[model samples]
Structures are given as structure tokens and as C-alpha cells.
Target: MKGPPMPAPLSRREFIATSAAAATLATIPVVHAGGSDLLRVGLIGCGRRGTGAATQALHADRNVRLVAMGDAFEDRLEESLATLLRDKEVADKVDVKKENRFVGFDACEKVLASGVDVVLLTTPPHFRPLHLEAAVKAGKHIFAEKPVAVDAPGVRSVLESCELARKKNLSVVSGLCLRYDWGFRETVKRLHDGAIGKIVALRANDYRGSNWGKARQKGWTDMEYQMRNWYNFTWLSGDFNVEQHVHFLDVCAWVMKDRYPTSAMGLGGRQARTGPEFGHIYDHFSVVYEYDDGTQLISNCRQQPGCKNNISGHVYGAKGH
Candidate 1:
């Protein structure tokens, strides 16, 4: 039996326009060329990464303003806005009003309807699919962070949203920065240009200490606590592999000419941080990915502290490594 039919290949315009880039909210040139004067941005998450993205967006262009902000918690939303206000360079561009400050689970929907041209989906991986669909439906450009989804179903949803965005001529850039880094881009280009010859095997590693986590406060419910400490739960963050190590995996795929692995077998478990506060995610993962061309990608990532950090990847080819 034959497999399912493939979609038509993306044209050069679609490829260039929809390709994920580093600058999330700095696409004012496109917006301006498309006959827009100002770029209004809405931030859906208020954590460190979200705040940083917002700051970058504000600094990217003078015609850009943060018109809306949303988060699951009011305090986080307030803190993010205050942080933006304190930034002297981008302070004047921060114009989020009181009514535009949305809090609670439905904050994303409200932000999308707040007369914004761009929306940053910086929430946890679990909420990404829902928020992205809403953004695309509202005809807003998107800057979704890495690990777009926590599970396969969410990934499918995100793909559908991206397709819709493409059809609408809207840009959807990802949080994957490796694609934008000049150094990495040049290196990958050389590798693809036969600098490494016929590549055979690859190795990637991301060994580091635990990321931030918070103890449950007094009045917070289980749901609230999980949302606050999202990184610890696989349902929220997709574990360290999807949440953090996706960069390395992406690098591996880029080296392989964008050919993803076919399958893999792996085992992971919590070693150092086994407390209940850490949730149910494993602290380490080791997997070997097998591609259709017989290439293998050995990947590993860990979150235990003081375990000799090593964050690098290498591709071995026939002519040279």
C-alpha cells in the first residue's frame, strides 16, 4: 500500500516568508512594506524569556509598541510590565493599558482581540497549540518559542496553525535561535557544502544543572503550582529534552540537511533531583536516533548539578569529522 500524499512544496516566497527567524517581533520592515504604519505586539507569557522577548521586540523598532500583555498570574503580568517600563530605551514604546492587561487562563484570547498585529506565544509548551491556533485565526503574526508543543497531538495542532498562517500570508517565526546565529549558520553552511564530506554519524550533548523551580506557596492549588513550576512537569515543559535540548537536536537535523531522524530508542530516569517538587520528569535522557539513510544521531541531555557540563555537537563524515 502507498503512504499518504504529501503536500505541495513551498514556493520560494513562502519559504522565505514563513521560515523561522531569530528576531521574533522585529519584522516591522515586512509590516511596513505591507502598508502598516505601526506594529502592535501582545505578550502572552510574563516569565523571564517572555519579558526578554518583549524587550527585544520594543528595541527592534521605533514604530513598535507593546499594546497588550497576558499571563496566568496577575503578579507576573504586573512584574513584566514594570520591567519593561524600567527599561529607559524601550520605556516610551511600552503602552499597555490597564484594560489590556489580561490575566487567567483565557488571557491569550483577550490579548489576541486587543487590536494587535503581532502576538508572542511565550507560554508553556502545553498552552502553545491553543494560543498559536487563536493567533493564526486572528490573523496575527507569531513568534512562538522553542518546543512548540509538549505532545504529539499538540504538535499536530501547531502544524495546522502554521499552515493556516502560511495561507494567510502571515509570518510565524520560532524561538529557535541557532537558525539565526551567524556563527552557527556559517558553520552549518560549510558542513552542508561538503566541509565534512559524506556525513555518517553525529553526536550531541547538553549536560547542565537544573533550571529554575519554585516551592509551592501557601495558598496555591495543585494546578497553580504546576503552572508556576512548569519546567518540572513533562506535560508543561516536555521535559528537558524538548524544552532545552531541542536546540541540539535542531542542530543535528540542520547538519543532516534538515533530515529528521526516523526512529530511536531511549531510556531516562531521575537521578539527582528526585523530590516530589521536581514533578514527574526525568533528569536525564540518552537516545540514539536512526535515520532512513542509515545515519545515527546519538543524543544525551541531563539536568543534574555539578556533573561536568558539556554542550556541544559533532558530525562525523567519511572524509573528515
Candidate 2:
């Protein structure tokens, strides 16, 4: 199947009007069916985010228990479990035993098959499509992190999984926290009420730093090194644009009535983040996305250190901003 193309440096416009997001939470309340008064939860990709997500879920409901955990690295899985078990807030809700902790690329599938009613897919974006597909097939409700896929093929897989989840009456909650922010919600609501009049121009920035990567260890192959420092690689992390700047991009899409841009032209480069340890991701990017009606959304993202930082969006309208 044909997929969305990477933004090429062309004077011509290119249409990419599909939704630039993953499946959001179901409007209907998600009901758990593991057992009476208990929600068996599993966590895959046991990283900082994975641990945090599991903690949040446990805190969200007393009946929820984290029963399984998995990660591509055993160290990651162990550290996450150790941290979660040490935390006072939701420590009691974690029930992952040695047998239930899996490691390797197929670890997520093991967690899904562990008879958990709910699964938190906090894996890297490259692994998300595969994990989601497995979780849905296993009849588990999902709590997935944002930037669900790294490429068009992965996105396609996620879309198919979302459809399958819907048919199976499963809930799919993404980690797009902006959607739940009251301030953003109110602003969007008022914009619809003509507070911003007609939104004629959109601008956003994701200027920040600390896109860090570890130096390769002495006894590691390229595969081992890249897996440990996935964030710096395009294949694993989709570069910073998709991995980090997707937040602003998704917000822009949301503000534009959840419709994607008709076309885009962009330029970006490695710049100061140019080193073997940092892998191959560009440190800065600037893209201008055009809608069907010719309105434009311009975006800029930079990850170099010492740069003045800002994470903000603006909607300029004919009447007001």
C-alpha cells in the first residue's frame, strides 16, 4: 500500500490530508472485564514513560493492578519495576513477578498474552504499530503513547489496529496530554465561537534541548548501540520532528478542525547535533504546511543547546489573534 511521503524540498505543494494522529480514547466509558472489581493491567516497553503511565493508571483507579511488565532490555524492565515498586503512590498496585516480566522485541506480545485486561503501550514509536496490533488481537484495552508510528507503513498498521479495536469494543487512549488541558480546550472552543474570528494563519514552535544520546559502549554492535540510543535514529525515533515536534503538529491539526494539511514543503539539517554518538537526526527543522483553502501553518523545531527555548502556538485570525 502507498503511504505518506516525507516532506521533500520542493517549491510545489504536496497533499497529506489524512489525520496526523493515532486513535484517541473512545467516547463511551471503557469497561474492564478481567475480573470482578479488578483490572489486570500490563506494561510494555518499561521505560520512564512506561513506568509513569502505569503509575498514573494505578492512581487513577484503585481496582487497577499492574500485573505484567516487558521491555526490549532487561535492565530497562528491571529498573522500571524497581522504581515503580519503590514509589509510595501506586506501589501496592504493581504485581509483576519474575515470570511475567519479559524482555526482547517480542516482549510486548508476551505482555499482551499474559491475560491482562488493560495494556499500556509506552514503547518507542517504532515499536508502537507492532505492539498495538498485538494488543488489539489479544483483546486488551490500550493506553498508547503519542507519535504512535515512525513511518507511513507503521501509521497504516496503527490505523488498521484502531479499526480493529473499534470493532472489538476496545478502548484506545493516546498520550496526547494537550487534548485534556483545560486551557487549550477553552481556547479552541472560543476560537470556534469567533474569539479568534477566522483563523487565517497558524504558527508553532518546539524550540528546546536535551535530545541526548549515550556514547556507544566498548563491546556493542551497531544494533546494540542504536537500540540503546534509539532517540537519535530516524528509523527508531523518526527523528525529532515526528518524535518530539509531533506535539505541536498534532495541536495545529486539532486547532484546524482535526484535518491534516493538503501539502507541505520543508527544510531541516543536523547542524550542531552532528556526531556519531548522536546518530543521524537533524537538530532543527522548519516546515510550512498548506491547507486545501490555501491557509498555512508554519512550524519550527530546534534541539541545539543554548538556544532560546519556547513551546507555544499562535492562531492568527482576520478579526483577532
Candidate 3:
């Protein structure tokens, strides 16, 4: 279906002004552009990744400011703000008086309502759909991290939100930053130019050390702990396969210029880290995806320390390697 109509493009000056305003409010503490200048930014999650993302966004352009911060945990929000404030570059751009930091489940909405022009959705994959929907409804541009969703339902929601974003003329940049890298872009161009002939098969592997975190304390609700230790939960992380390995999956698809695989089968299970606190996620996974032309794509990923960190993807064509 056709998506919503795109919003009018912002003038260069307007864009700069909005970005600068956002930077001031978010606590980057940089010099303000001028009167009527502001690009307010809101952060939805306050985890390490989320805080890191906020740093990048603030540094992406001088015109942007982080004006609002929100998270379920007050400690996370405070820690993120402190870290941002500690950085001179970020501190100089942030407006201490105007910035509105919030906590609790509904804090996201408060941030949005506080006149943020850009929203950074760094929450867990499971909550991505809800956040995206809210941002789209508010007509705000978004910078959402990878693995947009953890399930079919969430995927459908994001797809719909993408449409709304298009209609609103909003820029929705995914966290698939590799796609923006110079080398990857050049490789994709070459593949599209038939530098790799008609691709027949592919293999990709992401082998690395474990990325496990301590479990939550007793008496915490499932939702609370799940949010804190999100990487360990299937519903929140979509497993290591879709969560971390999806990069390789995306790379293969980009090289082949295809999105859908006819069918997929895989086997995965948690071996080293065995405990109820670990949630339902496999520490190792190997999957085979078949395309319409009978082309096969094999992908394997493992999360165990001491293993080599090798990320390689190969494509086989009719002309042979």
C-alpha cells in the first residue's frame, strides 16, 4: 500500500536551528545558534547503548541538542545525563534549565510532548513498535537502533510506521550503520554492477566472545528485569541470531539485492550459560536460507569467549569464485 504523503522538506536554516536547540536541551552544552533556533532531541532508553547513541547523535551535527531523556529506571537516566554532562563538547551544548529529563514507563511520551523534533528510540526490540508508533504519530523524525522488532507483530508495526514516516516527510534512518560505510557501499555497488556475476550461494559467519550480563535481583518483576537485562531475553532481543547476527543477514541480502528468502531452517541452543535467569535464547545458531532460484545462504553465529572474532561473507556466482 502507498504510504502517507511526505512532509515538506525543512529549510537548511530550520534544520540547523532545530538541531542546535535539541543539543542545548539534551545537555550537550554547546553554544546556541541564535533566537528561534532549536532542534530538540529526546532519548527513549538510557542503557549503555542508548547513552552511546545519544552521544553520537549529539556529535553528528552541531545544530542538534539533546533536550529530553527518558527511561524506566531513574538511575539509568541520571547516569546518562551525568556522562553527557562530563563531556565538555556535549556539556557546552546542553541547556540545563530547559532540558526535561523523565523516568517511568510513560516518560517517552512526556519527552515527545516537550517539543522534541527528533526522537531516539533505544529501547528493547520488543518495545520498538510502541515507541515507533508514538513517534510517527507525533510527526517526529527518528533514529532507531537495529533489530527494529523481535516478533512478526512488531515487524508489521514498524513496517506500518515506516509508511507513516514517509508520509510525514520524516527521515527514518535505521541503525544499520554498515550500510553507510564507504567500503560496504562500494562493495554493494560492485555487486549490483555484476562484478560478482549471477550469485548462486553465500556463506556468512559472526564468531565472537560471549556478551552475557548479570541477572536481575529477586523480587523484581519479569518486565523490570527483562528491561534491565534485555540482551538475554528472546522476546526483547530476538535471540543473538536476529539481534546481533542480522547484520550479516542484511549484508548477504544487500550483496544479492534481495529481501525475502523462500524458506529458512536453523538450529540453536544455549550451552555454556545455562540458567533460568538467562531467559530463552541460544548461545549458538546456524541457519540456512533458500531463495527462489535455489540459491542457498548459510549463516552461523556463536557467543562464546576465546573464539575468534571473524566477520566474513562470501558469495558464489555462476562464473565460480
Q: Judged by lDDT, which candidate is best?
A: 1
lDDT of 2 by residue, 119-173 (tens): 8888778989998999889888888898899999999999999898877777778
TM-score of every model versus the real structure: 0.91, 0.89, 0.87
Q: In TM-score terms, which candidate is top? A: 1
Candidate 2: TM-score? Answer: 0.89
Better of 1 and 2 by TM-score: 1
lDDT of each: 0.86, 0.82, 0.77
Candidate 1, 171-246: lDDT as tens digits? 8888988776667877888898999789999999999998777888899899999999999988999998999999
lDDT of 3 at 139: 82
The CA lDDT at 3 in model 3 is 33
lDDT of 3 by residue, 191-281 (tens): 7788868888999899888787657798888788887888888888998888988898888888877566889998987887677666777
lDDT of 1 at 130: 94
Residue 153 CA error for candidate 3 (Å)? 1.0
Clashing pairs in 1: none
Count clashing pairs, candidate 2: 2
Ranking by TM-score: 1, 2, 3
- Lowest summed lDDT across 10 adjacent residues in model 3 is found at 19-28
